[model samples]
Target: MKSGWMRGIIILLVFVLGLSIGYFLPDRKEKMDVPVASVGDEIITELMWLNQLKEDYGEQVLQDMIDRKVVFSEANRLGITVSDKEIEQEIQKMRKAYENDEQFLNSLKEQSGTTLEQLKEDMRYYLTWEKLATKDVVVSDPEIEEYYNNNLYLFQEPEKVHAWQIVVSTEEEAKQVIRELEEGTDFSTLAKERSMDLLTANQGGDLGFISLNDSYFDPSFLEVAFSLKEGEISSPIPVEKGFVILKVTEKVKERIIPLDEVKDTIRKEIALSQVPSLPQVLDQLRKQAKAQILINDNGK
Candidate 1:
């Protein structure tokens, strides 16, 4: 019986492997013949172009394909060449990233309609253009500093408050609670006994630290709560249904950290902002280089 069970398991494994390979192999084979676009003597097939599209824009796959071909033509004109060894290394990195999941790797291969080898070649072309852009674009430290100064408000931390609240349905009940609190009633005990906010009533109505812009509480409540000094309690603030009395347990000042602490982040942002000029540089290179394009469906 054990021997029969082992045989069955082996057969099942073989069947699954066969199905997976069969499903992925057709897409890979089609990728070899698929015509994407042409750059000079290089013919990028439909499979190669679609794979590039999937990496960048999954929704508008065809547009990405056209854009990639345009970029590739520009890269070739600029003499931005990627070596086979570089492509191999990228493929190895991808394989490592998906090492734990064989199924995921297989699905990626099928979805791309290209084998792992072809994907690496596509990646090589993409990286070569990226490297060229990085090396050629000029963004100075002064520019970064200027951007930082202009956007200082974007980095300011808003004031935050931590407080406890008690919501009572009736004005008389609210007044009675205030009177009891004046007579030394425990706020937490009173909240647990009478407050209607089920989530925090047991924890003495502790609402935790909330930002001034928090949408949960009413604007009137926030206005009064923010104005109160720490440890000060507010008078019953009228709401839609009842009244809310709050104690300002804690208050944190808005903080703006120094730019020096984030200089590297600022520099990267500055560099990225200069990327649009790369294609123009590539265009100049194309004017100086020899290129050819052959379209199979010229009339279309």
Candidate 2:
């Protein structure tokens, strides 16, 4: 299952208990009378909103929750557990996509609308589900080695440089920036203070690892960026956005990742491929558990 498929599931579970915050009130009349909106002459109460939510998302959300519960129950019965360390490792793997921990967290919030703890809980559920689903599946050593040999290109890392830049609207401005860097001024500080690239300026122009094949970067920028040695700063290079001076902080030569580093990942991939899809696994689990739905569409 995709890591973020549970993004909005938790909030949807709230509908199972009550729709609005006022549902927790001590007085029955107040709970029923809580207004959700004003329709000019009419007031829409919490009950109305609750009914609407139930009508729209209630059945699918309940089924999702049921699937989660079934997995957890089966895992508990079988003593299959996902540890905090395992979850952290998975999170670290996911974190590789971002520049830093802060960037990852920020992107997680922006893209998934979830906090770290919520993400952890989601991971726990997903990992537990995987363990339960794939417990019977086996991947042999030969299979892993064969898969690795067949997909060697997938393991190759391209030549990349961890670089920072200071973009200015004028060539003279860029030249002065370089002069400051040549003297004693800090590159990151100068970037924050003067760089015009709004996306990276606030982050001290951190262009975390760019490869020559990265199509998003301008050809002129890549030409200058890739040519510079580590710790060496480029002269003002003209681009669509006036001038950009790059400093390569770190460099990595192209190489294939070792099989040992990716063996467990390969094993998991092979095992998962052999097992039923996640939804199918959940459906089977529900059957084994003899799960029953107590609610119906008619609210009977």
Please estimate how well model 2 matches the true structure, expressed as its whole-model Cα lDDT.
0.83
Off by over 4 Å in 1: 1-144, 183-189, 210-216, 260-268, 271-300
Estimate the TM-score of every prediction.
0.40, 0.85
Q: Candidate 1 on 1-300: residue-level lDDT in tens?
A: 112222333333333344344447876555455565788999887456444433443323333334456667766777777788767655554553331234335645455544444455457655665656665567677887887889998667778887788889988888888888878888888888888876567678777766778787788888998998998777888888688778888899888857885665576566656676646645544454433333322211
Cα error of candidate 2 at position 253, Å: 1.0
Model 2, TM vs. native: 0.85
In candidate 1 the C-alpha lDDT for residue 75 amounts to 69
Q: Which structure among the candidates has the greatest lDDT?
A: 2
- The local distance difference test score of each candidate is 0.63, 0.83
Quote the positional error of residue 144 for candidate 2 in Å.
1.5
Tell me the tens digit of each residue's lDDT in model 2 across 175-250. 8998899899999999999999866787898888888887878887888889999999999988888899899989
